[model samples]
Target: MDTPIRMLENTDEATKQTLENVRKRKEKFDKFERYHNQSIWATIILTSIFLIYLYKTVFTVYSYSFAAMFSAFVNDSNNLTFLVCCVGMYGGMNLLKEKKDKAEKEYHDLRCEIVDRSKDYWKKEDEWKNRHLVFEVMKKQYDINLYHEKK
Candidate 1:
C-alpha cells in the first residue's frame, strides 16, 4: 500500500499538468464561441437585407412586364424566369441560415464542456493541495526527530 504522502505527490503532479491543459482549451473554446456568434448574426442581417431588395426589384419588374403583356395579348415567359430566380435565392438563404445555426450550436456545446472540465480539474487540484499539506507536516515532524537522535 502506498503512503498518503506518495499518493498525494503523484496526484499533485498529474492534476497540475491537466489543469494547465484545461485552461488552454477553455480559452480556445471561448474565443471560438464569440467568433461563431458574431458570424451568425452578421449573416442573418445581410441575408435579410438582400432578400428585401431582391423582392422589391423582382416584383416591380414582374408586375410591369405582366401588365404590358396583357394589354398586347401576348404571353410573357420572362416573368416566370424572374419568379424562379427569386425562389432559388430564398431557398439558398434558408439553407445558409440552417448551416450557421448548426455551427453556432456546436460551438456552444464545446464551450460548455470545456468549462465543466476546467471546474472539475480545479476541484481535484484543491483536494490534492490539502492532502499534500498534511503530508508535509508529518514529514517535517519525522525529520526533526531523526535530527535530534543523531546527537
Candidate 2:
C-alpha cells in the first residue's frame, strides 16, 4: 500500500521522527535513481541518432567504405562539434549517477540507523520487562516489593 500503516500508536516520538526521515531519504534516493536512468537512456538515444545522421551524411556524400567513413567522421570539423556535445552529455550523465549513488548511500545509512535504534529499544524494553517479572516473583516469594518508588 502507498499509505503507511501505523502499527504502534504508542511508539516513541524519536522513533517516529527517525522513521519519517528514513522514508524521506528513501524517496529522494528513488527520485535520483530514476533521473540517473533517464539520463543514461537519453544519452544513448541521442548518440544513436547522431551516429545515424553521420552515417547517412558521410556514407552518401563522402565515401561508402567503412574505413573512409570512419576517417571522415573523425576528421570533419562539424563532427567535432557533435563529439564535444556527446562528451558534455556523458559528463552530465556521470554527474547524475554520482548524485544517485550519494542518495542511495544516505538512504541506506539512515535505514540502518533506524533498524539499530529499533533493535536497541526492543532489547532494553525486553530487559526491563524481565526485571519487572523478577520483581513480581520476589514480592510473592520473599514478601519484598522491589518496585517501590521512594518519595
Candidate 3:
C-alpha cells in the first residue's frame, strides 16, 4: 500500500485512500488502548477501596493485631462477596488488556506494511541524511572562515 512516504514522493488517489485507512486504523487502535487502560485503573481503584473498607471494618472491630485481623477476615462470611467482585474485575480487565494488545499489534503490522510498500522510504531517508551531512560541513567551514577572518 502506498503510504505517506510514497505520497511524499508521488501523491495520487491510491495514496490518499491508503492514508485514510491508516488514519482509521490508528484511531481504532488508540480507542482500544484507552479503554484497556481505563479498565485497569478502574479495577485497581475499586480493589483499593475494597481493601480500605475491609481493613477499617475488620481491623478496627477485631483489634489491631495481625492474628485478630486474619481470623476476622477468614471467618467473615460476607468477605466472600468482595472476593468474587475482585476476581470478576480482574478477569474483565485481562480481557480488555488482550483486546488492546491485539489492536496495538494490528496497528504496528499496518505501519510495517506501509513502510514496506513505500519504495521511496529508504531513498527519502538517505536524502535527509545527505542533506544533514552537507549542512554540518558547511557550518564547520563557515566557523573556520570566521576564525581566520577574526585573526
Candidate 4:
C-alpha cells in the first residue's frame, strides 16, 4: 500500500512537469508566430508603396515625353519647358529606384529574420519531443518495476 501511494505521487509530479513544459513551449511558439506575421505584413506594405511610386513615375515620364514632342513643333519656348520637364522626370525616376532598392533590402532582412526564428522554433520543438520520449520510457520502466514487485 505504501509503495502504491509513493508511485502515485511520483506519477503526479511527472505529469505536472510535463504540463509545465508544454505550456512554455506553446507560449514561445505563439510569440514567434506573431513576430513572423508582423514582419510579413510590413514587407507587403513597403512593397506596395514602392510599386505605386514606380507606376506614378513611369506615367509622369510618358506624359512629359508626349508634351515635349508636341511642343517641339510649336515654339522654341516649348523646347526649354520640355527639357526641364524631362530632367525632372528623370530625377524622379532615379529617386524612386533608390527607394525601391532600400525597400528590397529591408524585405531581405525580414525574410532572414523569419528563417532564423523558424529554425529556433523547430529546435525547441525537437527538444520537447526528445524530453517527452525520455519521460515515456521512464514511465514504462516504472510500471514494469511495479508489476514485478507485485508478483
Candidate 5:
C-alpha cells in the first residue's frame, strides 16, 4: 500500500516527493495558525481593556456638571483609536491564516494526482518498451530473409 506507485519494482519517488510537499505545506500552515491564535488573544485582551476604560471614564467619574464630565470623557477617547487599529490587524491576520489553510488543502489533494499520474506514466512506458521489442524482432527476421534470398 505504501509502495503503490513506482516506475518498475524499485523506487517510489512520486510518493516521496508528494509527501515532502505535504510536510512543507503543513509546517507553513501551522506557523500561520500560531500567529493567528496569538493575534486573536491579543485583540481580545485589548478590547476588554478598552471597554473597561470607557465604562469607568464615562460612568464613574463625576464633575460639577454633566456637560463638563461628558466633555472630559470625549477628550480622553483619542487613545481608543489605537486599540481599534490593533483589533483590525488581528482580523486581517486571521484572514491570511484562512488563505494559508486553503493552500494547504490544495497541496494535500495534489498527492492523489501524483500517484495517479505516476501509474499512468509507468503503464505507457511499459507499452512503449514492448512495442520496441517486437519491432526489433521483426526487423531481424526481415533482414535474415533478405540475406537468404541474395544467397
Candidate 6:
C-alpha cells in the first residue's frame, strides 16, 4: 500500500500539511514529557511525606521530652497522651498512605501516556524521514530544491 509519506511527497501542496503535522507531533511528545515530569515530582513529594511521618511516629516519639511528659501525665503505664499521640499518628499515616497511593496511580498513568506519545512521535518522525528521502531523490532528478523552492 502507498504510504502517507509517499502520497504527501507526490503532492506539492502537501508540504505545508507535512510541516504542520511535524509541529503537532512534537507538541504531543513534549506534552506527555511534561506530564511525566510532573508525575515524578508528585511521587517524590508523596513519598517524602510518608517517610517523614513514619520516622516521626516510630523513632522521634521516643525522645526525652516524650518520656518525661508521659511520666508526669500518669503513674500507670497506660497514659491518655500516649494513646492520643499514637492514634493521631496512625490517622495521619493512613491519610498520607492514601495520598501516596493516588500519586503512584497518577505516576503509572503518566508513564503510559509518555509511552503512547513517544510511539506516535517516532512513527511520525519515520514517515517524515521517508518523505525527506523521497524529496532528495526528486530534488536530484529535477535539479531543484523542492522543499524551499518558490511555488
Instruction: Summing lDDT over every window of 10 consecutive residues in candidate 2, give the lowest-scoring window.
Output: 1-10
Q: Ten consecutive residues with minimal summed lDDT in candidate 6?
A: 142-151
The local distance difference test score of model 6 is 0.48
Q: Of the candidates shown, which would achieve the greatest lDDT relative to the real structure?
A: 2
Residue-pair clashes per candidate: 0, 0, 0, 0, 0, 0
Root-mean-square deviation of every model = 16.5, 13.9, 12.3, 17.7, 18.2, 14.5
Best by TM-score: 2
CA deviation > 4 Å runs, candidate 4: 1-11, 63-151
How well is each residue in 1-151 modelled by candidate 6, as lDDT tens digits?
1244344443344443443344344445545655655555665565566556545654465456766545544553434444555556556655555665555455444434433443343356556466556555434543323354232
TM-score of each: 0.38, 0.67, 0.63, 0.34, 0.53, 0.35
Instruction: Flag the better candidate by TM-score, 2 or 6.
Output: 2
Compared with the true structure, what per-residue lDDT tens digits does model 4 show for residues 1-151?
Answer: 2233234322344343433343343344445555555555555565555445444644454566867544543444634554455555556555555555554444344334423443343345555444444335433533211111121
Error of 3 at 97 (Å): 1.1
lDDT of each: 0.47, 0.65, 0.61, 0.43, 0.53, 0.48
Task: Assess the local accuracy of residue 90 in candidate 5 as a C-alpha lDDT between 0 and 100.
Answer: 76
Stretches of candidate 2 above 4 Å error? 1-8, 64-78, 122-151
Better model by lDDT, 1 or 3? Answer: 3
- Write one digit per residue (lDDT tens) for candidate 2, span 1-151: 1123123333444654655565666678878999989989988987887788797879887775889888888887878887788888899999999999998788777655544454453356655355445434434543333354220
lDDT of 1 at 17: 47
Task: Name every residue pair that clashes in candidate 3.
Answer: none
Candidate 3, 1-151: lDDT as tens digits: 3233233433345544654555566667778889888888888987898888897889788885889888889888778788888889899889988888887676566555644565542246565444333323323532111111121
Predictions ranked by lDDT, top down?
2, 3, 5, 6, 1, 4
**Order the candidates by TM-score, highest first — what do you get?**
2, 3, 5, 1, 6, 4
Candidate 1 structure, TM-score to reference: 0.38
Please say which candidate is ahead in lDDT: 3 or 6.
3
Candidate 1 achieves a global lDDT of 0.47
Model 3 alpha-carbon miss at residue 26, Å: 1.0
Worst 10 residues of 4 by lDDT: 142-151
Off by over 4 Å in 5: 1-11, 62-70, 111-151
TM-score-better candidate, 1 vs 4: 1
